[model samples]
Target: MANQLSGLDQIFSALADPTRRAIVMRLCAGEASVGELADPFEMALPSFMKHIHVLETSGLVQSEKSGRVRTCRLSPDALVGAEDWFQQQRATWEARLDRFEAYVMKLKKEKEGAAAKRPSRASKRKGAK
Candidate 1:
């Protein structure tokens, strides 16, 4: 559970910034260098680099220095935490729905059983015979 919480912390922290979220979305296309990642943004290199740094620290991106260029790649496992969280939410919803279904079925059966025990209008009228 601690690991899950930490993973959620990282996911939320990394996503808190719009710039970092945009970077993550862009990185979905493939790996990219810092310059390539920063090209679309109007911010300075230092500001943009901060976003990259956050992403790297969050384990959302992997970067390595090769000569003068630092290339960054998306880490697929970083999303596992978020996916697990979503799965847990889905399971809870499904269980709630299943419970609701059972309740409704029980109500339906009770209604039918009650009706079965009561005399119909036609049967009551036939008592004139």
Candidate 2:
């Protein structure tokens, strides 16, 4: 569990950068050579490669060298645990919000019922006069 959380931390950290995210998005269609992947950005190769390194370390990407070219591909399965964690959190929050809404509705109904049992202030004033 600790290891899984650590991986999640790394994945999230890698995704925190826009350049890394764009690289991941591009890889979604298929694998690409490092040069092709780095083409869209204006940064130096070393700087760009740092982003790639982060993604690789996070396990969200896999790269292999063929001849002189390093081709990278997305590792879709790496995100499964993170996605599950998000879904579980969404479910838990939705349930809590539903309960809160129900409680508010119940309070509203009770307030209306109590008001129905009580006389209006105008009527009380008239009776007193």
Candidate 3:
């Protein structure tokens, strides 16, 4: 569990940067050389490489070196852990909210029941008069 969380943290950290995210997005279509990936950005090659390094380290992107060209691709299962975590969190929150809604409904019903059993102010005033 801890290791999974550690990996998830790394993945999230890698994806935190817009540059890295964009790289991942581009890789989703298909693999591309590092040069091709960096072409759209204004930053220096070294700076762009740093983002690629993070993605590789996080296991989100896989790269191969063929001579001087490095091609990067998105790993199909890279986000599985994060997606599972999100699903579990969503289920837990939905359950809690459902319970809260039930409790509120109970309280509302009790309040209405009490109101039904009570005499109205108008009736009391009429009797007094």
Candidate 4:
């Protein structure tokens, strides 16, 4: 569990930078060479390479060199752990809410039952007379 948290932290950290996030978003469309990926950014190649390095280190992107050209592709499964965590949290929250709803309904029923059992005090006094 600790390791999973650490992995998620790393993933979040990698995505924290705008440049790195942009790279990931672009890769979603399709694979592209390093040059192609770098073209849109005004920053220097070395700085852009650092963003690529973060994505790679975080397991978000995979890169390979074919001869002189390096290509990058998105690894969709890299976010699986994060997805699983969110799903589990949602499920837990939903279950708790369902239970609370049930309890509220039960309380309402009990209150109605109590109200039904209670007679008017004036009717009781007239009966006593």
Candidate whose TM-score is highest: 2
Q: Write the per-residue lDDT of candidate 4 for residues 1-129, one digit (tens) a residue.
A: 998898898799998998889899999999999999999999999998988998998899999999999999999898999899889999999999999999999999999999889997988899999
Clashing pairs in 1: none
Going through the candidates in order, what is the number of backbone clashes in each? Answer: 0, 0, 0, 0
Error of 2 at 6 (Å): 0.5
lDDT (Cα atoms) of all candidates against the true structure: 0.91, 0.96, 0.94, 0.93
lDDT: the better of candidates 2 and 3? 2
Tens digits of per-residue lDDT for model 1 on 35-77? 9999999989999988888898889999998999999999989
Give the TM-scores of the predictions, in the order they appear.
Answer: 0.74, 0.91, 0.91, 0.71
Using TM-score as the measure, name the better of candidate 1 and candidate 2. Answer: 2
lDDT of 2 by residue, 1-129 (tens): 999999999999999999999999999999999999999999999998899999999999999999999999999999998998899999999999999999999999999999999999999999998
* Overall local distance difference test of candidate 3: 0.94
> Which runs in model 2 stand beyond 4 Å of their true positions?
125-129
Give the poorly placed runs of model 4, Cα more than 4 Å off. Answer: 99-129
Worst 10 residues of 3 by lDDT: 15-24
At residue 84, candidate 1 shows an lDDT of 84
